[model samples]
Target: MQWEIVVGLETHTQLTTESKIFSGASTAFGAEPNAQACAVDLALPGVLPVMNKAAVQRAIQFGLAVGAKVAEHSVFARKNYFYPDLPKGYQISQFEIPVVQGGTVSFLLGDQMKTVRLVRAHLEEDAGKSLHEDFAGQSGIDLNRAGTPLLEIVTEPDMRSAEEAVAYAKTLHTLVTWLGICDGNMQEGSFRCDANVSVRPKGESKLGTRCEIKNLNSFKFLQAAILYEAQRQIEIIEDGGVIKQETRLYDPDRNETRSMRSKEDSEDYRYFPDPDLPPLMISPEWVEQVRSEMPELPGQKQARYTGDLGLSEYDAVTLTASRAMTDYFESALAVAGADKAKPLANWLLGEFSASLNRDDKTPAESPIAPELMAALVKRVVDGTLNNKTAKVVFAALWEGKYSDVDACVKGEGLEQISDSGAVEKMIDDVLAAHPGPVAEYKAGKEASFNFLVGQIMRAARGKANPAQVNEILKAKLS
Candidate 1:
């Protein structure tokens, strides 16, 4: 029987705040196992939790960026659970009512635009880490991360394939980083994904039982986990076995997900409003303030690039893929004139991109600063150097062989000879020498013209402007 794969994602985005959500404890990564944990994080006797205003502001910023409704009042609920890592025995999270109510996240899957409807993005605290390694059959608990601020963004089951799920995850990562709300670093656990995967008959309307794969940090792992889980469910159903609703852990080494525990619904957690904290409140003025302070979104920037700057949609999309890329392009544009936008785009997307990949550095980290990039492209625009010579100058700048573009061109003598007289001399000499080919041209061999043009450029040691060589050579021949 034909089967259809369904997927949804719950992304935990650690807010870019210096402290934890409910305490003043430091949220910096790589601290000693318990060095950063405070009394509140430890759930000490008579200790109370206090909300971080910065975290709330970040949530509001995210809400505004996604066009979600920022609720005027939201409440924090205690999710009762027992684990060594969860010191409080109950995690403070938003339930019944969340801060960011509803929105849509859209991304490109190949050439088609796919949008995943957002159920809610709620604020919550993260649990600490459990260390099972480097111990003699004993487990260690680290509470430093217990109170970290996280915005749990939940999506509906709208994705149909592993590829689509990956695309959605990438788009969400970019958005969070672009908004400056989250660092979006998967390696450090700043961003984590829980994928709910299931499979049903292709024509079936009702959803099948889903098994949640927990804590997929990388996009590659997410794709692999979803593919494996979906196949597992399909096989079970095909064999007349029931698909169980449970939480599973993906083993990247083995490339499969193993059942962790039975998945719990809202009721199973025994959620209730926290007594220590009152209902979180927001006002229209506050939402407006955050909205006013929001940066121009990626979609807005893409539209401006295509509609106003006359860039192709593909170019606009490529340029705005990340904040670093867009900043680099704009910084170079600011240095180079607006009239050279197309030329600058070409260089940025082509030579610059290839160089960055080869060097394994981001555009922001490139040794050739945007100003220097602009200087090189400007030389090309002004005909000081042709494309070939401009690349030579670019390489020299990247290698730190020369500091200024003009100096590099001058020191290397790489400038194109655009002077008509200089090019004419070279062309005249070429015509005087290559008589056989010149004769062939007069005998109506059109290829001979190209041959003579190459000879002229060679005679000038490739410094002669190509356009000048072609024009003067044709005139002398005529």
Candidate 2:
């Protein structure tokens, strides 16, 4: 029997607030072990937790972005648990009523659009880190992240393959970072995913026993972990063994998952509403205010690029893949004029993208400024330079050797020879000098025509406008 994989992702997104969710402690990353942890984060006696207004606002912003219903009233519950890093002995989180509910995350899987239904997104405090390294047979606990704000966005089991799961993760990452709510930095643990994967018989209505892969920070690891976990479950089922539901950890070195512990259910957490904190209330007016402040979402931008800008669907999608890239393209387009959208898009997606990748930089980090890029494209459009010569100027601009497009063209002597008279003179010289090839062309040898054009371009020292050269060469030969 064939098995089908099912996946659901629970993403913990660290809010971009300067302080922890329920405390005044700093939320900045990479501080000394416990320097950022305050009395509230340390759970010291006589300390009470206070909610961060910025964290709540960010959660509302995300809710509106995903078209989810932001709850007017929600409750905070204490998730009772005991771990070395959990200073409070229980985590403050949402239980039955979360802040956001019933949303969908849509992404492109190749050319096909796939959407994952979100169950809920709740505001929670992140646990601290347990350090095992640099200690000899002992562990250390750092509570700096104990009270950090996180939006736990949970999704339904809507994915059938590892590729679909990865696509969903990447789309979510782009959206969160675009919203400015989260940095979406997997390296710093700002955004982490826990994938619940299972394998069931094809066409079966019943779900199989699922295992949660904990804290996959990388998309490549998420995909690899899911694939490995699915195969592991399938092999067990095929061998007439039962699949146990547990939490597993992915070892990148081995490319496999090892069971950490049995998976726990809601009942296991012993959740109860906190007495110190009142019911969280959100007004309809507040939601509307947040909705009004939201930036144009990716979907909205994609539609506008295709409909108003007349860009191809693929081009629009590629341009809107990241906020930084979209900003770069739009800024260049504004300077280059609206009619230059196609060329601007091509440069951004083609040469600029390749250069960025080669240098291991993002569009935001590129040396080529938007105005400079616009100027370069404008020169090509106005026939001041052909594509080949324009690239020389582009290289000089990228290397910071030239700040102005015109200066670079003049300094390098790479300007296109667009003067009709000058180009005609050169072509006439080429035809006169190459009599044998010209005679062969007049005798119906079509290949000689290309040879004559090459000679004319060589005569122009490679700066002649190719289109003008071809047009004039064909006319003179006729």
Candidate 3:
């Protein structure tokens, strides 16, 4: 029997508030083990936790950005659990009432637009890390991540495939980072995906037993882990075995998930409202204030780029993929002018993006300024540098070999031969070398003219203007 995959995701986004949720400890990454954990984070006796205003504001900003309702009154609860990394023996989270509710995350899967409905996005404090590698059979607890603020965005089991799950996860990642609520860095553990995957017979009303794949930090792993887990369930069911509801870990190197423990239900955690913290209250004015300060979201920017700026759908999607990429595109567009937006986008996504990835650099760390990139695109707009020569100039500037495109072009003598007389001579030289193509063109073979142009460009060392070469070659053959 054929089986269908069912998937859902719980994405934990670490907010970028300068401090932890209920404490004054620094939320910065890469700190010494446990140094950033304060007495409040460690759950010291006689210490009461206080909510951070900035963290709530960040959550409010996310709700507004997604067109979700921000809860006026939300409560924090203690999630009782025993783990090495959890110092408080219970996590502070939102259970009965969450801060943000009823949002949709949409993404393009091929030609179709798919949306994943969010169950709720709740505010919570993160658990610390359990380091087992350096302890030599013993484990160490690092409380640096403890008390860190996280907006746990949970989605309904609306996803039908692993690809759709990944797309939804990526869209959520982009949205959180674009809103500036979270940094969305997977490497430093700022963003994570907990995927619930299962397989059931097609057309079944009831859902199959799912296993949670925990802590998928990268998209590649997120997809692979879900697919592997789904297949594992299908194989077990087909073999007359049972699919258990458990939590699993994605071993990226092995490209599979192994059972970590049985999945817990709400009652397992023994969740209760925290007595130390009062019921959280948010006012309409606070939501309005955050909405006022919000930037244009990815969907809005994409629409503007495609509808207002006349960019292609693909180009618009690419340009507005992230806040940083959108800023970079517009920064260069500002310097280059609106008329050059198309080429500017093409270069940004094509050669410019390739250069950055090839050299392992980010848009922020790029040595070439936006103005310099604008200059490079402007050169392509004019006849000074053709497309091929522009790439050469970009390569040089990317390598720090030249300070500017003009310098690179002049240094490499790659100036396009736009002069009619100079281009005519090059075409004449090509005609003299190849008599067969000239005769074929004279006999009304129209395609041979392209060959003659290529010969002309080759002779001119890719410096011949393509339009000029086409015009010059036609004239020479005529």
Candidate 4:
């Protein structure tokens, strides 16, 4: 019998507030160790915590974005735990009641739309980091991250495969980034995921023992880890061995997972409400204010691109994957107009993407202006330049040395030769030089026609318009 994989994700997204969650300390990344920590962050004596209003507002904004119920009131709880990174003996998080609950985030897998139900998203403070190196027989602590605000989003186990899990993660990442709540930089730990995975018989109603994989920071690693862990569990069950409920870590080098420790349940943390901070309250007016400020989300934009702009679903998704990319695409389309959307989409997805990848830059960092890109697309569509010539112009624009697409085309002499008389003469010359192939074409050798077209293109130094050349060749040869 086939085995089905079940997966759920708990993502921790660090809020983009200017200050720590419960302190006035700066929440800047990459600061000197202990530099940004305040008395409250250090948990020093005689210091009390105060909630940052901006952090609370951000959580409300996220709740609105995800269509969740923003609680009128939520309490802060102390999750008691002992760790080297945690300056305090307890972590300030929400328990018993969270800020947002019972939401759904919809994403597309191929052509089908799927919605993953959200269990809860709560407000919490992040712990500091422990550095093991650069200290002789001693570990170092970086309190810069202490007291930073985070939104712990938990999703129900609605995913059935590794692909679905990765897709869901990516969709969440895009939504948060587009909403400007989080930067979604997985490498910087701004966005992190802990995946709970298990396996069972294809038609079974009961789930097998599930293993939790922690600290997966990349989408590729998340997919790989879940795949490996699910297969491992299935194999163990098949061999008469039972799967263990434990925490594991993904080793990217070996493409495998190793046991870290037994997984801890909610009771292990010994949660209790914190006495220091009061309950968080969200007013209806505050929720309405944040909802008004939210920009158009990715899913909405994708639908508009497909229905209004007449783009394919694949094209719409590709264009709306990132906010910057979507902005670039729309700006280019505004100049290119609706009639040129398909060609413009092709250029943006093809040459524009390729150039950005080659330069190790993002679409946001691209030096090419949308107007200039629109001009290049116009030239190709209007037959002022061919595909090869447009590529040359694109390179010049990417290099930042050229002022505009027209100047690049003129400077490189890459204009298309559309003179039908000139093209016909070239075609005749090729056909006359290859009498055998020309005779073979007349004798029903269809492949010889392609040979004649190549000869014509070669003779014209690739500047000839391919379609015009084909038309001229067919008329002359026949």
Most lDDT-accurate candidate = 2
Candidates 1 and 4 compared by TM-score, better number? 4
TM-score of 2: 0.93
Put down candidate 2 lDDT per residue, 1-478, tens digits, no spaces. 9889999999999999999999898999999999999999998999999999999999999999898999999999999989999998999999999999989999788889889999999999999999999899899999889999999999999999999999999999999999999999999999999999999999998999999999999999999999999999999999999999999999999999999999999999999999889999999999899888999999999899888989987898889889999999988988999899998899898889999999999999999999999999999898888877888898999999999999999999998888899999898888889999988999999999899888888898889988999988888778
RMSD of each: 2.8, 2.4, 1.9, 2.0
Worst 10 residues of 4 by lDDT: 469-478
The model with the greater lDDT, 2 or 4, is 2
Error of 4 at 191 (Å): 0.8
For 1-478, candidate 1 gives per-residue lDDT tens digits of 8999999999999999999999999999998899999999999999999999999999999888778999999999999999989988999999999999999887767777788999999999999999999899999998889999999999999999999999989888888999999999999999999999988889888999999999999999999999999988888888889998999999999999999999999899999999999999999999899889999888798889888889987788788888999999999999997788889999999999999999999989998999999989898888788877888888889899988999999999987888888788778788888899999999999999999987877777777778777777777788
**Residue-by-residue lDDT tens digits, candidate 4, 135-192:** 9989998989999999999999999999999999998999888888899999989999
TM-score of each: 0.91, 0.93, 0.95, 0.94
Whole-model lDDT values for every prediction: 0.91, 0.93, 0.89, 0.90
Tens digit of per-residue lDDT, candidate 3, span 1-478:
9789999999999999999999999999999999999999998899989899999999998888777889999999999999988988999999999999988888888778888888899999999998889787998889999999999999999999989998888888888988888999999999999999988899997999989999999999999999899999988999999988999999989988999999999999999999999999999999888888889889988898888778987888778777778888899999999889899999999987887788888787787778899999998889898888988888788778988888889998998878888888777788999999889989999888888878888988898788778776766566
Q: How many pairs collide in each candidate, listed in order? A: 0, 0, 0, 0
Ranking by TM-score: 3, 4, 2, 1
Pairs clashing within candidate 4: none
Badly placed stretches (over 4 Å) of model 1 are 421-478
Off by over 4 Å in 4: 442-444
Q: Stretches of candidate 3 above 4 Å error?
A: 441-447, 475-478
Clashing pairs in 2: none
